[model samples]
Target: MKLRSYLYIAFTGTLIATTFSCTKLNEEFRGELEEADAGNIDPAALLINAYSSLNTPYQQEQRWVLQEISTDAAMAPTRGGDWDDNGMHRAIHLHTWNADNGYMNNTFVSLGTAIYNATNVLRFNPSNQQIAEARFIRALTMFDMLDLYGVVPIREGESLEDFRIAPEVLQPEAAIDYIVKELNEIITDLPNNGPTAAYVANKNAARTLLMKVYLNKGTFINRQSPTFAAEDMNQVITLANEITNSAKYTLSVAGKYFDNFAPDNDTKSTENIFTLFNKNGERGGNVDRTWNTVAHYNMRPGGWNGWCTLSDYYDKFAEGDERRGIYYDYAADTTSNRSKNFKRQNVGFFAGQQYNWTTNQPLMARNPSTAPLVFTREVTIRTSGATLETAGIRPVKYAFDYAVTGQRNNDWVVFRYADVLLMQAEAMLRGGTGTAAEALDLVNDIRVNRGVTLFTALTLDNLLDERARELYWEGWRRQDLIRFGKFLEAWQEKAADPDPKTLVYPIPSQQIAVNPNLVQNSGY
Candidate 1:
């Protein structure tokens, strides 16, 4: 609930001096930025800045490209020279990346900066409440690091050098235990009103994190043959039950799930448990990168016309389900002059001919033979010359924000109540104490609301698909696939059976260069 950004400067001469003892202060400046007298800065702002760091890796398209593009849920085809960032996009799609990938390095840096900034906040001697929030943020980032890179650089105590100089790198299993312990310690201090105020970290947020951690513990500990231990699954059920018992959230109203991603979603939606508050024109407001990537250039706010989903994923949705919203047919409007914005509501996946707003004419594909801009189900890893502009179905999960000049006001929902319900259901389905009927009911709770038909039974495979249907583009695809053991399976554009090491991304080569303690992931 504390959203004010009171930027203040604080001097930590002791921190700076102590850190410089082992490592040169000018070498990397690992701890505090200031060495001499700097004004006392507000710890709240620092904490908020740590919160803002979520926009960098967690909320952005780069992480999405890495997670989804590497799996069957999505792909980023090399559209000629446009999206081909020196074959990096193709490399991820083809399951052939190494330690030196730029996105990999960038993700590590962003997450590391988040952890470091949170540590700086703690060094300011914040209130117990503030400290709890900072710890939650740090733990969440560390968990992400563990999930993506299999190792987390954990800096403890007041030693700022510990943040840089041979910091302890917790492997996946250790990282999970550390995160679980951190959340359990801070859960009580976190506000119980997260449902009412979705921006700030709350007890419910910590609970959700615990649920996720417990659910993925098997995979974290044993990547090759992840077995859901009974105790761990029970813990997941307990955490999920604690959240559901609170009665703070439920499925969004039918045909209005978009309200969660609407421009005013931060305050408007009750389903969001925790969110990254993104205000238009603010530093973190440009969170609509995914929306911009898929939208056409002819939009009212011109789109980048990049990033789309394969038809195989698109076809997962049942017919007439509101989740699979109507794709307007502009083929009827065939006028010549193409000067205005397109007049079509392409929400879920766009396939047919796209039209111009003013002229009502269908736009031609860039490729001569691939006119009519028809997106097909079949997509190849190499889409340089043969693939046309309409190669894949573009996704618009977050409703296009037409009001803002630069970015939408939709706060990125990091943890929502619907996700809690699904987690609880999954925990039950995996032989937890919760009933199978209850698990099926929870799945139906989300589905029936979205106009999706109620399932007679819930299986692990379809439950995974149901997760994809409900939570795609919001992140979690990679983790979900790994938990279900489907991550290494070959998909359309990616035919190579992924190596076990590919289960977790390689630690950035640049990181190993700077930190001797850090070890590169295997096969890189």
Candidate 2:
């Protein structure tokens, strides 16, 4: 996980050393910071740290698999790399987590830790504003757990020991209630949407997350829960309106699509409502591009191969889908242009390929990561560095900085306004209550803004396909598939993958080993 340094500076009147332990509490717990001292902690600083923590682990679990694999945006080669699980990538991306695959471990643990730490900040007597922000963060983490794992013991409290989540099967419906209640109480407390791309959980951000709570409401929280509840769907609509109505946030008019993922653009993401903070100097800052195909090329003089986009996924995009050109390029085109696109891998030289000793080859035979191909050509052919980067099917969205002294570091936007636009649309589709056309229109609005043709049709299949093209690698694909009813459909290449039992992934086997109370999902 990326380091979350949401640090709390000791304020003017923090508890005097050794004088603040409550006798009723255990002595061990008493010596640490007290509830009273929390009042002195800075809310802004605490919030920054909390946001920074979101990035670390995502580079692996989220950036690569959750978004890219699941979305039709990219895929792994069946023959060559570790990413061969792209079917499962689509499976996992498509939201079919069964008992057998081990997805929950990293998800639950990482989010749980964030909740733990964020809850710890709950110690400081926060401004009602801070209270609202802190509550939203903690609740968001649990919701993450709730979405993937299903019944998580909703842990709370300052320390891990003090945290609580029972082994009981927590239903999705119940989880939604918790999320709604928390956000409603805190939404008023969130700051007005601001211009900074870093940590800023204002009312709109809260609403956006809450809308997500509702958008995925059917499958996770309650199937009976209408996706377009005036109460629920409006949160998204209202919030999106708030941004558009108010000048607080603005979508880029020039529509430089790549800027959204560029390493340097991290802090200035106007559409990004919330993010994992990273910058040039910090250790993990700008660190994402390092693991992505965009970054490794910076360090490899031999031109480390970029993330290959899978043919299956690439096929999902219609020729009109401009994102295909923006996010991934055909290897043949790069050769024609006589250029080498500079994308990189996290585990460079000495990673997983049969390359000789060099400190910087991402594919150099690493044991843990087989380095899946983002596109197919990566496995079948090796391109000379001189070739135009358009050759292979890897992600070209994230920017690289050869100028950076070492590991190029920058924060990643976890949730953004564009996501809210899509979620609002999905809720409309499922419930048929809101403006489905408006929902669908917002997507094409993005495409139009990007100089791409607007999506003309708006069927469930069409929207899913559009989502795959527009938001493919953004990490919403898995849940998108299930909610749209495609999780059970037959796909030719997945190898007898028809069993719908694959929907809810198993809690990692390792987690069960540690806590016997944690039962495995069925069919593991």
Candidate 3:
């Protein structure tokens, strides 16, 4: 894959200053520079802005919290005074979030910025490749925005004020149609899958995006009814076939499975279809948050000790699955910077008494637990008051970059072939042309290779569990739960009787405030 350098290009100072002031003055600002007037501005840089906007959503783990933390797969426990972002984290887990919830609002803004930047690229008379890549990024952004918010604000040509007035909102069907049309029109212009095609969108990447949109079209259109259309499922199957038949990807297994997330994953993993390229400290990136959220402060290259996997979800993995990669190791003494004192754990769930590697003694937790920082299997979904440091089993799913400061060099995988295969299996089982036996085999292939026990039969519930085990912390949990008709089901500390409106996030309060045409999702 081409090493995508994260480049920051600054527009004119006057333009930026005016734009910020316009936001405060309640006036719309537009990037209206024409191709001729662009002077020395590189058209590719504008598209880079669109790609950079991805960092905005995934940067601070906002999407992960929305997708994984809100679902039963994971949670950001409020450890006492820490991680209590004004109850935002807790609200998501409990499905009690309102329109003003900070994280939801941030997500709304981040995706909107992606649309704006992509539109900027389209405004210029760029080459076909630039146009396709910009539209692909725009389509991907809109798909997620529509999926989560149930409405997409398409920023039409060079005029934000006019566009906002009676902004055309693309609801589920309209959004999917729009995205599918965009991908289909541009797939031929995209680059083919190869070593030079990792970070950028390729034909397979577009197909994968189309597959995802088609697979979840039913849920996006009507979460309440959510009847999988045969045509959509067939589209999913067809697209999956294109990706698999290309033979450009494979399922990473056992010893090499972790390579998909390690610091050098971009070079080692053959499975990543679309991923965010990151070089530590060059431009701020997100791989750090994956490990930082779970690693103990006492461990070398310490973590925030905030987020952890829910125990019930942890149990989904079979006993000897290599994917269940958590194990206790030596922890470092922060006071003296020595590593021989306490045991550190990574990935999956951590529990029981943590031991010091030096004297094999119990180390005290910061939260003053009676036991030696024993992380428990059970945790309150809503941690309102004091939450102990060792309350839940920390999940360190991605390989941590202990070598870097602040940011990690690991490339974040957005779509992998394994996920593509599973999507095909899902399409087959969900009323597509393929047989159930074939679907089970597709899933078992992943399971056996990952060194996990295989299922004799595949139930809808079983498939959901398999997805959780295989793709946990990769940001597919919420989507999977909703499609499987289980998003509103009660689990761990969440309420089963959640409102159907909870399926889609409320159109952020600020968005509705700015654009009256934007309607809030049903039950906000």
Candidate 4:
């Protein structure tokens, strides 16, 4: 296989020129390649491009916006005229979104592009390791497509000649089976968990994704009322135990829980199972958006002052829970170069009055110039008046990366060991091979590590709240809500949605226009 054979020149001219290492894999290719020069093409570069595709959907706006903003865990309120992008954010939170929603359309296209890129790697004669990695990437993207949209368009065969052919659509049931099969087949070829394994496709990464698939198999099959089969629960438990038994990961201590998301989290984190690799001057997504999305405009980094968690969700954590928030002086800390010039800012949730860390002066809200910048618990979808910019609690999941003016070094987490434990516990509680006492112990283990009180007893509701407290703003809230049967329930700015069709987003209209085989999901 040669580079020119697979490059979709007309459609991916920019991607080929900038992203792929094949310099001549663009419109300039005029069949001038010598047969001997074919050996010069690096298959690893193509694999890296496949891996790079994850940055857009996972780290940046499209998928993260759909996953987080549509749930009770976070919302992008229309603060006067600032974040009101023609009601895109409001439609998501209020469950009034349609197929025309730009976020939904972009997310669908981005995931499809990722899948196409990953599959393109197979057309070239790559090594076994590269083949396994590319297949894993394809499976992961396809899993997301199946979760968000009910159908997945699968390109058949490892032939670029079939690029124009309409892909075979896999419905929910078949999609789940296909993902499970792919992961199982490639798990052994992937690298073992080690220093750099978190950023690459590895055995534990495959195991963690498998655990997610099995635990949510019921939810993926039926979002309205999920049924956890005993066998599927056992699969979840087994996969979690395999990862735990590897001894490569453990929960970060109570004081260092935020380290998992720090700028140098690539080395500092002990709990990350898999993450998207990023560096200051590298080709990666804008992870700084995690903080810039919510921080006050007057803060050290001068954020956009958008999106926040609801008060109802904020009340889930106790006062002493370190996951709630903790003050950290980024300027004083002598750590990575990424934290240079950063003023003091809290790591977790931010509420009440904020201040300039260096000057020790109260920060003022932009709306009311004289009033202090005090974040309040009350917020509305269409915000106005004095509280326009001050309402809603802010969350800073990733530590501030103030050194670089461009892409930050914080590696965006895709799976963490804490989530592994929670999944195991939930599986046990939902009729897996463990007892209720064992499930409670698993939940308490994480609680104790996070400086929170242990529960004397555990229920599904308590487990859901615990997940919210621990995994808030991490982009799993919507899926968790649907799995636990609380997605349609009203909370804060949203009211109960009478239609269950809102559970799965509609297949993007653009997709249906391009691929006639695609049928739009029921509602929209």
The clash count of every prediction, one per candidate, is 7, 64, 4, 0
> Each model's C-alpha lDDT?
0.73, 0.52, 0.74, 0.80
Residue lDDT tens for model 2, 1-524 = 23234444432111111111112343334345444365565666655455544564465454235434543344433324433443444345344554435445555555655564465556655678777877877777777767666655443333233312223334667767877888888877777755363455677777677777766665674322224455555555665666566565555444354455555454445676766555555534434443454323333333444444545666765554445543222221222112444322212112122222233233322222344312223332233332323234554444444445665544555666666666667656655356667777877777676566677766677777767766655666666776666655544233434555555556776556544446775567
What TM-score does candidate 2 get on C-alpha atoms?
Answer: 0.72
TM-score for each predicted model, relative to the true structure: 0.89, 0.72, 0.89, 0.91
70: Cα error in model 1, Å: 0.9
Q: Which residue pairs show backbone clashes in model 4? A: none
Ranking of all candidate structures by their TM-score, best first: 4, 3, 1, 2
Q: In terms of TM-score, which candidate is stronger, 2 or 4?
A: 4
* Candidate 3 lDDT by residue in tens digits, 353-454: 655434556665654445466667867754543456666777666665555566666777788888988999999888998999999999998988888778
Candidate 4: lDDT over CA atoms? 0.80
TM-score between candidate 3 and the true structure:
0.89
Better of 2 and 3 by TM-score: 3
Shift in Å, residue 302, candidate 3: 2.1
RMSD of 2: 8.5
Q: On residues 273-370, what C-alpha lDDT tens digit does candidate 4 reach at each position?
A: 88887766545677878878888888877789888989888899998898898755443244322244434446888899887755666789875689
Which residue runs of candidate 2 sit more than 4 Å off their true CA positions?
1-48, 60-64, 67-73, 76-103, 157-169, 222-235, 266-268, 283-286, 289-307, 318-322, 326-392, 407-409, 431-440, 490-493, 513-517
Give the range of the ten consecutive residues with the poorest summed lDDT in model 2.
12-21
